[model samples]
Target: MDSLIFALNAVMPIVVMVAIGYAIKRAGFMNDTVTRAVNKMVFRFFLPAMLFLNIYEISDLADIQFGYIIYGAVATILMFLISLPLVILYTKHQDRRGPLLQSTFRSNNALIGVPLAEALCGSAGVVAAALLSAIVIPLYNVLAVISLSLFSGNGGRPNVKKMLMDILKNPLIQSIALALAILGVRVLFVKMDISFRLSDMTILFKVLRYLSNLATPMALLALGAQFEFSAIKELRREIIFGTAARTVVWPLISLGIAYFFFRDTFTAAQFAVLISIFATPVAVSSVPMTQEMGGDVGLAGQLVVWSTLISSLSIFFSCFILRLVGIFG
Candidate 1:
């Protein structure tokens, strides 16, 4: 009962926020243009600020467990590799293939996962999820660019050079890189016995905190506002497959492996990180990427909506079961 309540406490707020957003949209307070603008702001400014601050605030980088980091990266790549052939077999339409392949692995790690981690395991889990984000976000974007480009239906090959450029230009990746660079410099300052740090800039730090705080709520609202329910009949088959692959198959495989093999090795907080990575919904960004890359944008949107709705239950069960097994006390 305790674990059940704990899981509900963590998951319900997210569901409620999304529901509120959907309600606001239904009431005509927001429209397509507003939703797009909100999304762009969250992606370009708010989310990056949040990530940078989370990483920069970590007192000791050396204390972080690299094993989980490596596992996350490896697991992500494996998902991509395993998903490619499966998605190919599932769909012959090149445009559909790209979004479907992406749905299998890419998660809403930044907006949903970070906050969910904080909810599950407090500050420690947030740091774990943030660190994982530094690696996973870049990998997600790189693979997305490649997958979408490969199946773009352009009849020409993917432009490797452009893909590389896009990855470098990604704002999330850029923020993470900057945070790491600053962290390295802070280490050097420590060696020299310097006392000053970025956090000493009180006004700037507070401003950043404000921006960081806006990321999750505003992103959720935009996601809800953009959610549509009209295409279900037309895309039922693809939606069912993509949603199951994202919310069910991937989480069961990834979390099950972590539980059976690495349970004693990783802390409950670490397990929270795993749940955040694998059990979250498909990324809201996938919709835009699919559109930009000439994939079936409708399918991508539907997958995001359906997976998010289902992941509420999936994540709750994950937390409840893990807690029951003594992963959390």
Candidate 2:
């Protein structure tokens, strides 16, 4: 009952917040321009700040189990590979392949994973989810961008140099770098107290802390705002496939691998959190990435909405199943 309540408390409010975005947008309180601008602020500035602060606050990087991160990375790559086969064998729309794979495997770990973990498992879960985000962001972005651009018959291939440069410039990537740097310093000089004399560091800390706190609500709202009934109607097939792959197929695969292979190794909470991360739909921001890469933005948006709407069940069920298996019992 406690777990059920935790799930409801964490998920219900996020769903409502998203609905609020859609409602506000529909009511003309926030125009498209304003919506987009606010999203940028949230994404480029606020979200990165939040990630940096969370990662930086932890003095010990060595304790972060790289095994799980490696497991997640391998599973993500495997899912991507699985998509390639499906795209070639099943998908008739060659152009849709990139966007489909992107939605299917890449998760909204930062927006959905963190808050849900915090709600269900407290700060440790939040920190674990954050580490996953730090690993995933760059991998997902570069691969998705390149794949989408290549398949969409775009004018040219995505330049590797440009992509790397963009990754370097990305605020999330910057935060990850800073966080790792702090971790590195800590690991190198054990028991050494790290302090900063730079005035800029203090300002960055304050700004990031505030933004990090806002991340959960703002991201959920943005996710909700992007929901469109018309998009759902237009891209029904993509929506179904994307949502299924995200909220069901992906989590099942992750759980199977973690349980049967790494049985009794990962704690119940960790496994549950990982599966929950996989269960999350595509991020709200994937719309723009789709648009830029010649993929179908409408389809991406529809998938995000559909998958997110359905994920509560997937997460709850995964946890229930784990409990049955005596993992969480």
Candidate 3:
């Protein structure tokens, strides 16, 4: 019951915020142009700030368990590889492929995963999830850029050079890389007994925090404003497929493998972090990203909405079953 409540609590605010955005849109507060601009701002600015901070705030890089990180990264890449062919075969529409592919592997880890981790395994889980994020989130963005660019309508033949360039120019990727470089410098500073750190620059950090804070809510609002009820019928197949893959199949495979294979090797908190990564909903950021990248935004938005709704049950069952089996006690 606590797990169920925690699941609901983690998910409801996102639903409510999206509903509020839809309400305001219905009341004539937002239009297509404004929503498009909001998505652009989110993709280019707010989200990058959020990603940077997520990486930069890791207390110590040396403490990370690379084995856990390697598993998470490998799992993510395998999901992407597994989903790519499936998505291509599932949909004939060029623009729909990227977003559908993204829905399979990229989760709302930063927004939901950390808190869910804490709920499952306390502060230790939070630390594990955060450390995982330092790797997984950047990988998510890198792959998203690739997938979205590859399928963004190039006569069904992707321009490999342009795709590579897009990955390089991706704001999310750039921010994450910069954060890692700074983190490396900070580590060196610590070794040298230097006290300087980016956090010490209070005003700049505060500005970044302000942007970081805006990323989720504002993106949800933009998603809501552009969300169309009629599109649900048009996108019903994609929505159902994406949601089921994200909230059900992906978790079952990832968590099942972890349980049956690595039970003795991984800590409970590590399992919790895996749950946070694989069991969560499709990321809200996918909407903005799809919109920016010319993927089917309607389908992207629907996937986010439907997956988020379904993932509550997924999360609850995952926790309950894992606990029942003595995996998360």
What TM-score, to 2 decimals, does candidate 2 have? 0.83
lDDT of each: 0.80, 0.68, 0.92
TM-score of each: 0.85, 0.83, 0.98
lDDT of 3 by residue, 161-187 (tens): 998898888888899999999988988
The global Cα lDDT (0 to 1) of model 1 is 0.80
- The per-residue C-alpha lDDT of model 1 at residue 104 equals 88
Candidate 2 has which clashing residue pairs, if any?
18-224
**What tens-digit string does per-residue lDDT give for candidate 2 at 195-261?**
5422247876676678878765665565556667866665677777888988888888888778898
- As a whole number from 0 to 100, the lDDT of residue 217 in candidate 1 is 84
Candidate ordering by lDDT (highest first):
3, 1, 2
lDDT of 1 by residue, 170-207 (tens): 67668778888898899899989998788799999899
Q: What is the lDDT of residue 312 in candidate 3?
A: 96
Model 1 residue 311 CA deviation in Å = 1.8
